[model samples]
Target chain A: MKPIIEITDLYFSYDNKNLAINNLNLIIYEKEWVAILGHNGSGKSTLAKLLIGLLEPLRGTIKVNDKILSQETVYDIRRETGIVFQNPDNQFVGSTVADDIAFGMENQQISREEMKKRIDKYIKKVRMEAYLQHEPHLLSGGQKQRVAIAGALAMDTKVLVFDEATSMLDPQGREDINTLIQELKNDGDKTIISITHDIKEAMLADRVVVMKEGTVVATGKPTEILKDETLMKDCGLDVPLTVKLSQELKKYNIINDIYVNQEDLVKSLWEYSLIK
Target chain B: MGIQFDKVNYLYARGTSQEKAALIDIDLNIDLNDFIAIIGHTGSGKSTLIQHMNAILQPTSGVVKILDKTIIGGRKNRDINIVRKRVGLVFQFPEYQLFEETVEKDIMFGPLNFGVTKEESAIKAREALKWVGLDQDLLQRSPLNLSGGQMRRVAIAGILAMEPDVLVLDEPIAGLDPQGQKEMMEMFYNLHVNQQKTIILVTHDMNYVAQYANRIIVLNEGRIGFDGNTWDLFANYELIKKYHLDLPDITKLIIDIENKLGIELDHKINTVENLAQALVQALGGANHVR
Candidate 1:
C-alpha cells in the first residue's frame, strides 16, 4: 500500500539565520484523518505549506502519491491537494461566495455546466447557498469559513488540508466544522489533515502529530497522546474542557470513558447510572 | 474602577447600506478588580461591547460609563486620550499590532505617548517586560526576532506599560498551542491577582473561564445570553445546548452517566480534580445505598 503523503528528512527555512523546520519526516496513509498539533511558529503551518507545494523544502523530498515533490511537480501536486488557510478573508479572490467557489473550477478549465453544478452542489453542502450572492467580506467569520470550505470542497481535491481553519470560527461554528470534518472522514475516501490549536479537534482526528520548535516530537492516536499531561503542557495546550470534567467525575464512576467530547462523556455517565 | 454598560446599542457600518445592528440594549456592570470573561459566537456584539468600554467605539444609542464617567460624555476631540489610557485593549492576534524596532521601544511606546520621559519609559518598559516574564537582555533585540510567543508577550507588555486600570484582551489565545495558551492565561491571572489589575477577556475557550474567571458573560444574537459564575452556567445544561455550545466533555460524561445508570453525581464539577472527587463520592453513596 502506498502512502498518500511521504516526507523524509524534509528541512525548510525562511532565511539563512533560522531553519523554520528541522529534518522532519512523516508518512500519512490514504483516507486517514491526521492533525498536526503545535503552537504558533511551531512550524506546523510551514509544514502544511510545504506539503501543498506553497513552500519548497530546503533539503529532502516530499512524495504525494509516489510523485516526488519539486518545484516542477508542485503545481501538479496542488491539483490533487486543496488547502484552506487560517484567515478566510485572505484566501478569497472572488467578490461573492459563488464566484469564489467557481474560481477553482474555472482555473482548472472545467466545463461550464460541470462548474455550475459543482458550485451549486458544494454551496448547498456547506449550507451557504443562501449567501451565494453575498460578498465575502459581508459574511461572518463562520460564514466566510463555510465559503472557504465550499470552495475547497468544490475543487474535488483528493487531499484536504485545513490550516487553523476553525480558529476564526465561534464555538458553534467550530463544532459545526468539526462535525463536517468528521463527516468527510466518514466517507473514508479523502485524506484529511488539519493543523490546529484546539485539542478537542485533535482528539477527533485519527492521529495527532505533536510538533515542537520545528520537528515532529510525538505522533499517535488521540486517546494515547492526549493523556500525556507533560507533553500537552509543554506543547502550549491544555486538555479539553470535557476531559477535565471527566477527570472530575471519575470519583463517582459516572462518566466512564476519558474522552475529548463532553457529549460522549454525558452519554457514558447516563449509561453508567442504568447499569449500576 | 467598575465599567458600566447602560442600555447601550451599536450598529456596524452605521448609516451605510450594509449596516447591521450588532449590539442591542445592553445593560450590565462589571466591578473593579474582577476577572470577567465574555464568551460569544463571532459577530455576537461582544467585540462591539468591549470597544465601548474605552470609547474606542461610541454606542449608537445608550451610554458606556467607565470609572463613573460616561465614556461618550466627553467631547471626542478632547479628553478621549484619558479614556484610552484608562482601558488598554489587546486585540486578537495582537502580535500584528507590534511595529517597533525593539521590544524595549515597543513597550515604551505606550508610556511615551502619554508624556513619560524617555528614561522613565525605559524603566517602566523593563518593569513591564518583567511582568510578562521576558528578560531585560531581550530589550534591545528587535521584536520581530523574538519567538511568536515572545512577540505576543512583548505586545502585552506594551499594554501593561501603559498601566491601564482595566485591561481588555479580545481572543488572546485564539490559535496558540496548549503551552502558550496556559502561559498567557497564567499571565492574565497573575496580572489580575498579583498585580491587582482588572481584566476583561473575550474568549471562545470556556476552559479559561471555567478555570480562572470570577464571572462569565454569554452573548447570543447581540444580547446577554447569560451572566453568572462558571458553576451556574455549567449547571444549566439546557442553556448550554440551546446556545449550541458543548459542555466541557467531562461534565457531559457525568451527566450521561447519571442518565444511563441513574446515579447522582455532582453537577458543579469544573476541573478534572473536582469531577474525580464528585465521581468517587457518588459511587460511594450508590454502593452504600445498594
Candidate 2:
C-alpha cells in the first residue's frame, strides 16, 4: 500500500527563534499506529504541527493522502488530519459537548442532519452520549478528554494525532483512552501518530520513533527501542512496567524476553516455570 | 510544624447553585520534609483537595492549618502573604502562568515579591534553574521561547525560587515526553531528598508513585480512601482494585508469578534494572550460563 503520510527532510523553527525540528524524515503507512517519543524540547510537537501545516516548516515537505502539504493544501490537510491536544480545555471551542461536536461539522459545512448523525455516531463511539448536554467546565479531566476524542473522531479524518492526549488522565482514565485508541485503530483504516511522554502508551504503538535534539535518532518496534538500557537511560526513561516485570521475573528464570503487556508476560512466566 | 487538615470539608462553587462537596471530612497530617504522592481516579476530587493546601480555596466548613496559620482563621483574620509564601502550589501547566519577559525575571518574581533582595533573588533563580536542568544562558530569553519541557522547568523554577517549606504539584508531567517526565521526577525527588522540602505531588502514574513516594494517599469521591506506605498500597492488591487503583505492571507480574508458578517473590520489585539483577540472583548467579 502507498504510504498515507510522508515527510521529506522537514525542518521547522519558531518564527522568531531557533530550529525546533531539523531534517526530520519518515513515511507513515496507512492504518499504522506510530508513536513519536522524545525528551523535552526535542521537536515532537513541532513535527506534529509541521505534518498538519499548523506550523509552516522552514524547509522540506509534508504529504498526506499523496497530496503535497502547502499553504494551499493546509485546510485540506487539516480536514484530513485531526489532532487531539494534551489539555482538554484548550482544544474545546464550544460551551457544551453537543455544541463542541457540532462546531467542527458546522465548519466543514456539514448538513445539520448529517452533523447530528455524525455527532451521534462519534459521541456513541467515545461513549459520551450522556455528556452531550453538559458544559465543558462541568466535566472532569477524563470526561473532557472523552468529549475531545468525540470531537476529533466526529470529523472522520483519515489521520488522528494525539498530542499527549492521555497525559492528564488518571491511570484509569489513561487506560480508558488507550483502549479507545486501540479500538479506533482496530475499527478503521486511519493512521495514528501519538506524541507522548508516557512510555507505556508508546509501547502499545505498532512502531516507536525516538527523537533527540530536534532529530530522529531511532525508529523500530517499541520492544526493541525500549529494551535498550543505554537508549532508555539516554532518553531519561525506564522500561515499561510489563517489560520490567518480565526482566524481574527472570530472577526466578520465569520469563525470558521483555514484553510490554501483562497477559503475554504472565503466559511467558507460566511457560518458563513449566520448563524449570 | 508542617501542614495539617482537621476535619476539613471543601465545596466547589460554595453557597451557589453549583455547590458540590469537593472534599469530605478529611483529617490528615503531612509533616516537614515528607514526600507524599496523591493518587486517584478522575472526578475523585484530587485536584480540589490539593488546591486547599495553600488557601487557593479555603475549607467551606472545616479548618486547614498551614505553617501554624489556619486558612479559615476567620473573615477578619487573613494571612495571605504568609500562606502563599509558605506553601508553593504548582498548578497544572505552570508554563501558562509565565507572563514575565525573561526566564530569569519570571523565576525571580516570587522571590522578589517575598521581599528577597535583587542579588539574592537572582541567586535563587539561578539555583532553581540549575535544579530543573535548564541552562543559565536560557535565563535571558523569554519563557515563551523555551520548548515545552523547558518552559515547564522555568515555571517550576519560578516556584522553587520562593523557597517554600511545602511544594504541591498537580500532574506536573501530564503533557511531557517520557524523557521529560523522568527528568521532572528526578528533579522533584532531589528536591525532597537533598533539600528536605515537604513535597506533595498529585500524579496518576502508579508505577512512578510506587517507585518514588514514601507514602501514597488515594482519594476517592472527595474523601481519603487509602493512605499508607507505597509497598503496602500495592501489597493490598484487593484494596487497590477496590478503589480503582492499579499496581505497577511489574508488581502485577510478580503477583502473576505467585499465581501461576506457585512461587512468590520475597522482595519488592519496582525498577527493571533491580528486577533484572534480582532475577539473576534468583537464578543462581547465572554469570556462566545465559
Candidate 3:
C-alpha cells in the first residue's frame, strides 16, 4: 500500500538551543490507525505539529497523498489533515456545537447548505446530535472533545490527528472518545494518528510507534511493542496492567501466552488451571 | 472533624436563563486523617463539591463547616479566611498557577500569605521541597525553566507548605506520564500515611481509587449515587455502570476470571499484586500450574 504520510530526516527546535525532534523518519499507510506513544517532552506532540504544518520543521520533508508539502502547498496539505488538541476549551471557537462544527467548513468556503448537511452528519457520527444547540461552556469536557472531533471530521480530512485529546477528560469521557475512534476506524477510509501517552489507548491502535527524546525508538503491532517491558520503560512508559499481570503469571509458570485483552487473559488462565 | 457539608446546594448563574444546579442536597462529613476518593463522570458536580471544602465557593442554600468555622449560604462569614487556611485545595493543572521567579519563593508564598513569618516560611518552603523530592539546587532556579514534572512538584510543595489539615486535589495527575503518575500518587500516599493528613482526591482513574483511597464516594448527576469502601463500590456493578464508571483494570480482570471459572474470589483483591496472589491460591497453590 502507498503511504499516506511520509516524513524523512525531520528535525524541530522550539528554541535555537535544544532540538525537540531529531532525525526522525516515519511512514503511515493509508487507513492506518497509528498511535504515537511517548512521555512528556518526547517530541511526539512536536511531530504531530510538524505533520499538520502547525509548526515548521528545521529540516525535513513531509509528503501527503502524493503531494510534497511546501510553503505553497501547506494550506492544501492542512485541508487534507485536521488535528484535535488536548484541551477542548482551547480549540473550541464557536459558541454552540453546530457553529463549532461549521467553523471548519466555512474556512474551506463550503456552501451553507453543504455545511449544514456535513454538520448534521458528522455530529451524529460522534453521537453528539443531541448537543447540537448546546453551548460549548455547558458541555462536558468529553462532549466538547466530541464536538471538536466533529469539527475535524467536517473538514473532510483523510488523516485526523488527535494530540492527547482525551488526556484532560474523565475516564468515562476517555472511553467515549475511544469508542468514537473505534467507530471511525470501522469506516476504514480515514487515517488516524493519535499522539498520546495512554497505554490502554495506544493498545487499541493498529500500530504503535514509541518515541524517546525526539526519535522513533520502536514501531510495531500494539502487542509487540507493549509486551517488551524494558523497551517500554526505556521510552518512559508503563506496560498495560493486563500485560504486567500476565508477566507475573508467566513468572509463576501459570500462563505462557502474552495477553492484552482482559477476557483473553482470564480465559487462558482458566484453561491453564483446568488442564493442570 | 475535618469538614462537613450540610444540605449544600450550588447553582451556577442562578435566577437566570442559564441557571443550572451543579450540586444538590449534599450532606457529607469528612474526618481527619481520612483518605477519600471522589469518583464521577464529567458534569457530575465533583469540582463544585470540592470547592466548598475550602470556602472557595460557598453553598447557595446550605452551610459548609471547615474545622470550627461555619459558612452559611447567603450570609457573610468573616471567618472564611480562617476556614481557607485549614484546607488547601489544589486545582487541576496546578503548575499553571506558579508565577514566582524562583521555586523556593513560590513555595514560600503560600505560607507567608497564611501569616507565617519570612524566616519560618523559608524554612517551611525548604521542608516542603524536600518532601516533594526536589533537589536543593532547584530552589534558586526559575520555576518556568523547570520541566513539567518538576513544576508540578513545586506547585504541590507550595500547597504542602501551607500545612492545611485537609488537602483537596482535583485530578492531580491528569496529564502526567504513567511513571510520573505513579510517582506523584505515591507521594500523596506517603503524605497521607506519614503526615496523617486528610486527603480528598477527585479523580477519574478507578485504579488510583482502588489502590489508595479507603473510602470511595460516587457522584451521579449532582447526587450521592454511592458512598462506601472500595470493595463495596466495585461489587455494585450496576451502580458503576449507571454512573458511567469503570472498575480498575486488575479488579475487572479478576472478576472476569471468576466468572469464566464459575468460582468465587476474594473481593478484597483490588491491586495487581494482591490479585496475583489470590489467583495463585485459587488455582490450588503456586506449583499447581507448573
Candidate 4:
C-alpha cells in the first residue's frame, strides 16, 4: 500500500509552554479509513487541523502525495485535502445547498459548466438533489452535514477529514452520517480520516489509532484496540456495550473469547450455549 | 410539590403564514423527587415541554401548575421569575452562555440576579462548585481558559447556584467525550439521590434511560407516544420503531440472540452483568459451563 499522507516527529503547541501534539508520527495509506480516537484535550483535533494546513506545526514535517507541507506548498496541500468541522451551522459559507457545493470548486478555477455538472452529480450522490435550492439554515443538522460532505467531495480532493463531525447531531442523524461513511468506505477510492471519541464510529473504520495526552497510545484494527479494556480505560474511554458483555461472559467461563462487535459476540454466545 | 401540565399546546410564529404547532394537547404530572427521562427525536416537542416547566414559555391553550403557582394559557401571569427560580432549565450547549470573567462570578450570576446579597451568593457559588466537582482554585480563572469539559461543569454550577428544586437539562452530555459523559451522568444521578432534587433530562440516548432513570416519557410529533418504566417501553418494539427510538444495547443483543438461536431470553436485562447472568441460565445454569 502506498502512503497517501506521512508525518514525522510532528510537534505543535497552542501556548509556548504546552505541547498539544508531542513528537507524533503517523502514516495513512491511500484509500484507508482511519479513526483517530481520543478524549477531550487529547490533541486529535489539533492533528486534523495540522494536516490541512490550518495550523503550522512548531517542528517536524507533513508530507502529502510525496510533497512536504510548508508556507510555499500550503495552498497546494489544502487543495488536495478537505475537512468537515464539528458544527455544521458554523461551516456554511453559501446561502443555498447548491451554492455551497459549488463554492470549493469555484475557488479551484473550474469552469461554470464543469462546476454545475460536478455539483449536480455530488449533490445527488449525497441524496440531496431535492434540496438544491434550500437555504442551509432551514435544513436539519443531518441534512446540513450531508450538504457539507457533498461540498467537500465535489472539490475532488484526494483526502477527506471529519473532525468530530457527528458528535453534535441527534442519534438518528449520527447514524445517518455513519451510514454515509460506510458507503464511502465501500467505494474504496478516497482516504478518509475521522477524529472522534465514539467507539461505535471507530468500529467502522479500517484502522483505529488511539491517542492520549498528546501522543499515540495504540494503533491497530478496531477489534484489537477496542478489546483491551485496560487500554481503553487508560485513554479515558469506556469499551462498547458488546465488549463489556463479552468480558463479563468470559469471567463466568461461559465464553472463552472476546468479541468487539454485537453480531459476532451474539453469534458466539449462541454457539457456546448449544454445547451439550 | 411538583409540576403539572394540563392540555398544553404551544404554537410558534403565531398568526403568520408560517405559524405551526410545536406542541399539542398534553397532560403530565411530575411529582417531587422524580427522576424522569424525556426522550424523542429532534423536533419532537421535548424542548417545548421542558420550557413550560420553568414558565419560560406559556401554553397556548392550557395550564401549567408548578407547586402552588399556576400559569393559564392566554392569561397574564405574574412572578414568572419565581417559577424560574424553583425550576432551573439548563439549555443545550449552555457553556456558550458563560460570559463572566471569572468562574466564580459566572456561578454567582444567577443567584445575584435573584436578589441574593453578594456575600451570600459567593457562598452559594462555592457550594455549587463543589457539587460540580470543579477545583476551587478555578474560581479566579477565566471561564474561557478552562478545558471543554471544565467549562461545561462551570456552566452547570451556575444553574445549581440558584438553589432550584427541579433541574431540567437539555442534552447535557451531547458534545462531551465518553468519560466526560459518564462523569456528568453520575453527577446528575447523585444529585437526584443525595440531594433529592428532581431531574428532568431530555436526551436521545436510550442507554441512559435504561440505566439511570426510573420513569421515561417519549414524545412523538408533539404527543405522548409512550410513558412508562424502561422495561415496558423496550418491550413494545413497534412503538419504539414508530417513534424512531433505539433499544438499549444490551436489550437489543438479547433480542437478537433469542431470534437467531430460537431460544427464550428475558427482555428486561439492562446491564452487562444481568445479561450475562441470563445467558448463563439459558444455557441450563452454571453447571453447563466448563
Q: Of the candidates shown, which would achieve the greatest DockQ relative to the real structure?
A: 4
- Pairs that clash in candidate 3: none
Q: For model 1, what is the error of residue A36's alpha carbon versus the real structure, in angstroms, after optimal superposition?
A: 1.9
TM-score ranking, best first: 4, 3, 2, 1
Q: Candidate 1 on B188-273: residue-level lDDT in tens?
A: 99999998889999987776777888888899999999998877888887898888665655566667667765667677766567
Query: In model 4, which residue pairs have backbone atoms overlapping below 3 Å?
Result: none
What is the alpha-carbon lDDT of model 4 when measured against the actual structure? 0.91
In candidate 3, stretches whose alpha carbon ends up further than 4 angstroms from where it belongs are B17-21, B140-142, B238-244, B286-290
The recovered share of true contacts, given per candidate in order, is 0.70, 0.69, 0.64, 0.69
- Models sorted by DockQ, best on top: 4, 3, 2, 1
Worst 10 residues of 3 chain A by lDDT: A255-264
* Candidate 4 chain A, poorest ten consecutive residues by summed lDDT: A267-276
Where is model 1 more than 4 Å wrong at Cα?
Answer: A230-276, B11-21, B72-77, B238-246, B285-290
Listed per model, the TM-scores of chain A against the true chain A are 0.90, 0.93, 0.97, 0.98
Winner on TM-score between 2 and 3 is 3
DockQ of every model listed?
A: 0.49, 0.53, 0.55, 0.70
DockQ measured for candidate 4: 0.70
Candidate 4 per-residue lDDT over residues B53-154, each given as its tens digit: 999999998999998899999999998898888898999989999999999999999999999999999999999999999989999999999998899999
| TM-score per candidate, chains pooled | 0.90, 0.91, 0.93, 0.98
Error of 2 at B276 (Å): 4.9
Minimum summed lDDT over a 10-residue window in model 3 chain B is located at B281-290
lDDT of 1 by residue, A190-261 (tens): 999999987778888999999988999999998878877688878776666666666656545455457665
Q: Where does candidate 2 stray beyond 4 Å? A: A15-17, A232-237, A242-262, B71-75, B273-290
